[model samples]
Target: MVNGDDNNARITNGNLAEVGQFPYQAGLNVSFGNSSTTWCGGTLISHRWIVTAAHCLDGAESVHVYLGATNISDVTEPGQRHFIVDQSGIIVHANWTKSTVTNDISLIKLPRLIAYSQTIRAAILPRLVNGSYSLYEQQTAYASGWGRDSDSSDSVSPVLRYVAMPVMPHILCRMYWSGAVSEKMICMSTSSGKSTCHGDSGGPLVYRDGNSSYLIGTTSFGTSMGCEVGFPAVFTRITSYLEWIREHIPDLP
Candidate 1:
């Protein structure tokens, strides 16, 4: 009730994300009655910037980026595990459309710079990657969030969870989604049955290159069959939005 939406859910067939393992993970919370609730996930791309799904920002009220927590439920407890702050600026993609979901990404700016620590860090952008491995088809990538653990369940998990899924060809993904799999998107899934659900929206789809993690996509949407199904879940491709990202985060390297 304190961290996640009771009506929607997150990662399915995934394991818990240990403390500090995903320092860039964040929860996008909004006022719900007398309390706040996290309904979506996001990635900290810089000290003062976070990237999330455009749909998560549109039409939402009193929204804030909740970060520094591996387990968001701890916020509800007497002790603190996360930090919540109002966004200083928000940039929803100019091309974003609710009907087609063409540009389903947004940039959120914080008022102050976040101090770096084990549980809080910035993500590497795909353009800045100079690593041994660049993302490619069939390569494994990871997604982490605290959405529901089951597709049919309405309860959202309080613990951070993650799934390692393989990136697939857009053509292969088009087989499942038809016209919905746009060039601005990338698809990920596995025969092992790992995927994301509703509450996982706006979370980063990360690729590991050596010790650093690069953000390649942002959670967008999935099939109607739900998260547990082998259906390829589509994400907003980060690489395609580099120019837009730099337009907002001008100092980004």
Candidate 2:
């Protein structure tokens, strides 16, 4: 969903994102009950693999990834390109629990290798030494998705959305959620009124360093109250699970 006020923050809001701006962004289309569809955001880590949140996979069926997509729900819209590709496996962390939402990271395996392009490519993963990410206080990052623009209506944006995420101290962030925030997670929000909402789960929280953009975390969960209230959004830190990820996808780097 779009995170900020469109009237003032239109330039940085998710609703106006250009096509292929984020080459690694992945859009998920899953079967719901009979005909309904649910979408979740993720990032391509390799031609055959995706990294996302564990919660988004619960009860998912007929899953597909809209690769190289910017306008996910648009078919006739020009200047946009996408491919609804088949997915074979949905892998969740063994330690993931719905109750605590810990170990919320997960992976998706595609049956065939994807064709890379400017609009479709794998994401960069950081090399964490000794389990600590080198993020500093107040560091700003980027997150993209096609989640809701507002909870007023349960709708996902047709175009990809994004926001600048300012890293908040875990200790400071804990105050917003009654200490439910964990070390395995990172908390972020934008003073410009940007925050990740529904449908954004499993999306990548990116940090741009020089010419490279690294997938630093995966969207996990947020306050139960709702998404538009500026509550600190939580993410599963990738640095903590670098070993596990490497074990599963040996050639991820």
Candidate 3:
């Protein structure tokens, strides 16, 4: 179930005013109990570690994580709780290719620890593991979820939408995804129509450095037809997986 249109529009909880105002926003609402679903975009790099995608937990099972809440039914209570019981069953990316989108990436190990409030913190990885980030570099990238703003209906979005893309040029996104765009991938867009559609798969593509906010990428797919003009919204290049994400989350800093 992934359907919600108007080009997936509904991210207005302060409308991204140049990406400042932070108030706790990390995500995950994946389900697999009723009959197939989606929305697994995460980031909260530590406090118990979380970084998502791996095909949204591939088969799925009791996976429910909803922090802070831009409005996911106001998130019930329990101090904006947390849970990650998916064990480590689907740790993909040995050169992953379920059809081809290269190593979709995943990691969830959170049974407890996320208590960082100010919203709820943790997100800052990419302090120059290598170099190069200049597509003019105006820098202002953030992505939130509750996926499916469009792609003809799978229904998932109670409220929690965000988009501020701008960070393009991986050879112009491989000239519009020719050769399926890879080099570990990283590109963003938004002619003001805002993006990150189709259940915002494994979300979190942040960037904002003077106050702190850096998760490199993970939303991972795009071009279902429209986020507006010629498609463009791909990710999963968290510094080319920084040493395989510190050799499979060895307490990533």
Q: Estimate each model's TM-score.
A: 0.87, 0.86, 0.32
**Model 3 lDDT tens row, 11-97:** 222142212233335566566756765556677677777778777775567477766555566657334665656645335556656
Task: Score each candidate by Cα lDDT.
Answer: 0.77, 0.73, 0.64
Candidate 1 global Cα RMSD? 4.6
- How high is the lDDT of residue 142 in model 2? 84
Sort by lDDT, top down from the best: 1, 2, 3
TM-score of 2: 0.86
Task: State which candidate, 2 or 3, has the greater lDDT.
Answer: 2
Task: Please give the lDDT score for candidate 1.
Answer: 0.77
Shift of residue 245 alpha carbon in model 1, Å: 0.8
Relative to the unseen true structure, what is the C-alpha lDDT of residue 154 in candidate 2, on a scale of 0 to 100? 59
In candidate 1, which residue ranges exceed 4 Å CA deviation? 1-9, 31-38, 76-88, 128-135
* For model 2, the run of ten residues with the poorest summed lDDT: 2-11
Please name the candidate that would achieve the greatest lDDT relative to the true structure: 1
Residue-wise C-alpha lDDT for candidate 1, range 197-235, written one tens digit per residue:
768889989988799898999988876656666778788
